[model samples]
Target: MNHLKKCLASLALSLGLAVSSAAAQEAQKIKMGVMQWETIAMTSSVTEHLLERHGFEVEEVEFQEWGVAFAALGKGDVDVLISHPDYAAADYWERNARKLEKLSVASYGYNAGLIVPSYVTINSIDELNEHKEKFRGRIIGVEPGSGMMRQSENVVNEYGLEYEIIEGSGPVAVAELKSALDRGEWIVSMYWTPSWVFQEFDIKFLKDPKGVQEPTETYVWLAHKGFAVQNPKAREVIASVFVPESALTQMTGWVKEGASIDEAVARWEKANANRLDRQAMIGNQ
Candidate 1:
C-alpha cells in the first residue's frame, strides 16, 4: 500500500509538470497583422509557420491598409508585424515611438527606385517631359499614401512636367502597367525592387537627376512592447527571420503567379530549410 501511494503521487506530479510546460508554450505563441502588399507577404507567413512548428501558435490578421496595421500594433491589438522602413513616412517607427516599443532586426537590404517597362522609349526624367504627351501626360502611382507616390509628386514638382498623378491600389497599379505594356503603349510611373514584377519583366530605372528620393529603403519586423516579456522564445525566432534579395524576388514571383500566401511561404520553406538556422544570425536589414 505504501509503494502504491508513492507511485501515484509521482505520476500526478509528472502530469502537472507536463501541463504547465504546455501552457507556457501556448502563452508564447504570437498573433500577427499582415499587409496584403509587399514581399514580406510570403516571408512573414513562412516565418510564422516555422515558429508554429517550434511550438508557437500564429494568428494572422489582414489589414486593408498599412496605416491600419501600424495602428493595430501600437494599440497592442496584434503581436507581430512585418514593417517597411521607407514606406509612407516612417509609419511603423512613428507608431512604435508612440507606444509599441519592441522591434526586431530588419529582414532585407534594398532600396526603392522609379522604373519603366523596357519598352519605354524615354531613358531619363528630363526626357519624359519632352515626350509626355506620348504617354497621355499621366504618371502612374500606387496607393495614395505610399512613399513612392510622394517621391513621384516631388519628381513632377521639381521637373515642372505637365503630368497628372493617377491614384490606385498597388495590385491595380501593377496590372495597369502590364495592360499598357501588352498594347505597346508608353507609360512612366513609380516602381520598387524585391518584387515579382522585376523578376518576370524586363524594366528600366528612369534617371532621377533631382534626387527626390535620396536613399534606398530597408524592411523590418516589429512587435508590441510586452512581446519580449510574454514570449522570449518567439522573440528570438522572429528576430532571426530574413532572406537575401534573390530569394525575396523569387517569393514575389511566386505570389504574382496567384499562389496563396501560405503556398508561397511553403515553397520558400522547403527550398531553404538549411538557411533557417542562418537566418537567426543574419544582421543588417
Candidate 2:
C-alpha cells in the first residue's frame, strides 16, 4: 500500500510538470499579423522560420486591409506586423501610433503604382483617359481600402478618366491582371514592387506625371506596445531581417506563381544562406 501511494504521487508530479512545460512553450509563441500582399507574405514566412530557430513559435494572421491589421496590433490581438506602414499605410499608422511602435525598416526601394503590359502603347497615367475604351474603361485595383486603390481612384478623377475602378483583394487583382495579360488583353492594374507579376510578366509602371504615386518607399516591421520589452530576442531578429529589392521580387514572383509560403521561404533561405546566417549572427550579438 505504501509503494503504490508513492508511485501515484510521482506520476501526478510528472504530469503536472509536463503540463507546465507545455504552457511555457505556448506562452513563448508570437502572433504576427500579415497582409495578403505578396511581399508581406514572403517576409513574414521567412521571419517565422528565423524566429523558430530562436526558439520562438510564430502565428501568422492574415488581415485584409491596413486598418484591420493596425487595429489588431493596437488591441494586442497580434504581437507584430510586417509591413510598409510608413508609405503605403501611413494613415493607419498615424491613427494607431500610440498603441504600436515601429521597430525597424526591413526593406527599402518599395514602390507601388499603375502598371501595364509592355505591349500596351500607353506610357503615362495621363494617356489612360484618352484610351479608356482600350482598357475596357476599367482599372483593376486591389483591396478597396488600400492606399493603392485610393490612389487609383484619384488617378481616375485627376486625369479625367472615364474609367471604372474595380476593387478586389490583392490576390484577386493579381489574378485579374494575369488573366487579362494572358489573353493579351489590355489591363492597367494597380501594382507594386516585390510582386512576381513584375518579374514574370512584361509589365511597366505607367509614368505618373501628376506624381500621385509615391516613389521608392521603405517598409518596416511594427510591434504591439511593449512587445520589444516582452520578447527582446525576437525583437532583435525582427530588426536584423533585411531583404534587398532584387531578392524580394524574386521570392514574391515564386509565391505569385502558386508556390506555398513555406516553399518560397525555403528557396530563399537556401539561396541566401550566407546572408541569412549573417543576419542571425547579428541578431544573436
Residue pair clashes in candidate 2: 196-253
Off by over 4 Å in 2: 1-29, 130-147, 166-187
What is the C-alpha local distance difference test score of candidate 1? 0.73
For candidate 2, lDDT tens digit of each residue in 148-216?
Answer: 888788877888888888878777877888898889989888878866777777899999888877878
Find the candidate with the highest lDDT and give its number: 2
Q: What is the lDDT of candidate 2?
A: 0.82
Which pairs of residues collide in model 1? 108-285
lDDT of 1 by residue, 140-167 (tens): 8888967678778888888888899999
- TM-score to native of every candidate shown: 0.75, 0.76
What 10-residue stretch in candidate 2 is worst by lDDT? 19-28
